[model samples]
Target chain A: MHGLVNRAIQSFVTDTYGPDRWRRVTEAAELGDFEFEAMLIYDDAVTEALLAAFCADLGRSRGEVLEDLGTYLVSHPSVEALRRLLRFGGDSYVDFLHSLDDLNDRARLAVPDLHLPALDLREEGAGRYTLACGPGMPGFGWVMMGILRAMADDYGALVLLEHHGPHADEGADDEADEVIAVTLIESAFAAGRAFDLGARAG
Target chain B: MIAEDTLAGILARLCPMHLLVDDSGVIRRVGPTLQKLRPETPMPGQRFLDLFDLTRPRKVGCFADLLTGEGKLGVAFRDAPHTALKGQIVPLPGGAVIDLSFGISLIDAVRDYALTSADFAATSLAIELLYLVEAKSAVMGEYGQLSRRLQTARISAEEQAFTDTLTGLKNRRAMDHVLTRKAASGMPYSVMHIDLDFFKQVNDSLGHAAGDHVLQQVARILVEETRQEDTVARVGGDEFVIVFDNLTDRPRLRRIAERLIDRLQQPMLFQGRPCAISASIGIAPSVEQPLVSPAGLLRLADLALYDAKHAGRSTLRFATPRPAEPAWTRPAAGKDGETAPPSAVSGRDS
Candidate 1:
């Protein structure tokens, strides 16, 4: 796993739960004095161990924790760069939803070595979409659902989202594609946050 | 064939910035999107050439020239914001239809006109271009942060490597590097080797803590007695070396050595017990021997220190100048003949 991902997780935990709680989690995982460097690479097992320990310490399910991570990423002040990057997708909520299909390619352009799961957005009808997350990290659909809910709010649109676990035909393996169903109820529920093409203030 | 009324509606929906001109070069109609660029509506009597300046296909003086241009044409509104547009012209029976889009000025156009996604065609790649620009900014931000972190880490690591943990002075490796540069720099200098006297007795009688405290005191005295241009280094457990820059005067070097020895002889109290220690210093001035390498000079100082230790432990000694080697004793090797093993030295007072 790329260290940026792990560092994000560390930042999410420390920023939300406090450094003391993060220390306990690392201790419980038997990681003696470990710190994630943003530019280095780590074994995949390190991520698994960290997640398992975090889940055990908080008594929360893995999917729930990961979903909250996705929400924190888009809405937190510490990660405002991420919000600005995604807001460039479109001007309207519906336009942003259609732009999800190209999310993987766009992410690759920023950090070439970072590998995100492939995103395929399919429209079922008016204001209804199904986003299929290709096989990669497990429980990634929950994370996408969290991002969708936050972005909809950012655009001042009322939206409903449901995370459908991987298909049962894939036998509960990590290889099965997960899905998130979205229904945008109202595009202009209220005035949205202002955005400008020129990111910096003159 | 399509009716003129229906054709206008289709063009309005497809290209909101389109314009329809009459055979006399008078503007008959303007698309809804282009109408938003100006305040006045119903511009039916305005001449096409009067409203816009032909920037590309520069010879277009009349309506006939619009039909003869081959590739994409460029035009700018002769008003505030001066929005530039690029498009193609399709000739009709009586006039020409001109459909245009903002070329590279999309950012300023979007900002100035307050345009939204609905104003553009659904198939336009403008959204993709916007995404690319934002992505580049975000990536560059993080790239700059990464560069700063890498630079800070490199400088910190280098400082740590050259510092001694015990006395906070430059270590042996740093001394070797600096001395090598100084020796090759074609400048007269001096090297002094200092050894702590009865330091081992402090640890033997008291504890290693007292020995450590005494060594730190010795380091402080050495630093206090030398100028800032001199390099003071802890080269061993109880040994230190200083390279004095551009100072080869023998009497001044001896005075510095005596002052350092007098200061180090003071008893320092560690845990309320006075730990007595002294220092023996030996100096080699480059004026005495001009052709020695840094390593050879250090060895000469070491030999003088040996003489001081034998002449009653706490005194200072100066290395005597060497006699010229006999021609028969010179090596036949080329270029490095002077780098031979230094002969024995007899320390003497200046």
Candidate 2:
């Protein structure tokens, strides 16, 4: 796993659950006193160990923790720069949803080595869309659900989101894709949070 | 087969900045967008030629000349803040119809007039262009951030490559580059070669860690005895080289070398155990024999270092001028003591 991904998880845990909790988790995972360096690469097993530790300590499933991590990434003040980059997708919630297909490509422009999950959004009918999250680590669909729910609120749109975990249908084990179905109830249900094209000087 | 009134309505919807004039060159009507540009200015009922000055079709002076104008027309308001527009003109039975758009000034016009996508014709690509501009800005902002991060990483990597991790001094590679540059510069300088006297014994008696602590202390002492313009490098485990820029005075060089030897002779404590060490120095002042290559200079200093070691450890020596042959072919120490002081190495250039 990229150290940036691990660092993000570390920051999410440390900021939301307190530094003492984070220290206990790292100790439980046997990570020693070293912190993840953003520019370095680490073993994928390190991330698995961290997730397992979080689940064991908090008594919560890995999916629930990852979903909350997704929400914190978009809504946390420390990661406001990420929110600004995402807001450039478009003016409306519908436009932002359509831009997901290009999100991986756009992210690669900044960090060429980062591997974000590939997304395919298919419009089934008016206001109804099915998003296919490519096979990767488990629970990424739940993360996308959390991000979509938060973004819908950011755009003041009422939306119904459902995450369908990896499943095999008709005795074929190849259907490993995690999917999320979105039903946009109202594009402009209320006045959205104000956004500016340029960052204002403090 | 379209009625005149319906044609007027269609023109209004298609080109909101269109203008129509009668046969006498009187303004019959102005498009809704053009009127919004300056709401205080009454445009209709005025002479069409008086309201706008045709910038394109250079010699156009009246409506008749404009009809003969072959290419695209360019016009601007005749009043303050003369907003320019580019369009085409079509001649009717009595007058002419002129349809204008903001051209390249669309962004500024949108900001100045508070115009929206609804104000433009449905077929226009203005909305798409606006989206592209927004996307370009966002990508450029992220690109700038990436550039800054890469620049910082490059500088830190370069620093690490040229620095000795143990002593925190310039390593052999960095010293080689500096020596080459200084030798090529035609300025007289001095090269001082230093070797710790008891560094090996310290490592054997105490440990490698204690030897490291002693070397780091020796590095600090050497740096303190040299000027900021001089470079002190750790060329080997117990060997260092100092290039004194433009200093050839033997008396001052001897004093600095003595001070370095005195400092290195001090005992350093590591893990509460005292470890003692000393240094031997050899100086090759270029003013004695000028224009030597960097490698040749180091050879001369090495010869002097050999002589100092023979004279007993923790001492200093100066390299005597070489024969006209070259410093590279000069004989090493222990060959003969014929060049000892008061006999042969006593000649001063000035």
Best by DockQ: 1
lDDT by residue for model 2 over B1-350, one digit each (tens)? 66667767888888888888777778787778777887897678888678778888768656787776664788888986677889888888788788888887776677667765557676766654554455455446646765787899888887758788899899988888988998778788899999888789899999888888898898899899999999999998899999989898999999999988988887888999888888888899988867567777777787687668667779998987865424242243556643443222223210
Judging by lDDT against the true structure, name the best candidate. 1
lDDT of 1: 0.79
Candidate 1, residues A1-202, lDDT tens digits: the string is: 8776888899889999999888988888889667786666788889888888998899988778888888888888888777767887888888788778878888877677778889898999988989999977777787787788888878999998987866322334887788888988899997877766555321
Which RMSD does model 2 reach against the true structure?
16.7
* Candidate 1 regions with alpha-carbon error over 4 angstroms: A19-43, A90-94, A123-129, A166-172, A183-202, B39-44, B161-350
lDDT of 2 by residue, A1-202 (tens): 7766787788889889988888899899998665776656789889878878877899987667888888887788776656656765667888889878877776665566767778999999989999988765566677788788878878899999887856321213324778899999999998877655334211
| Candidate no. 1 TM-score | 0.63
Badly placed stretches (over 4 Å) of model 2 are: A1-144, A165-178, A195-202, B3-59, B63-110, B113-128, B163-350
The DockQ for candidate 1, computed on C-alphas, is 0.21
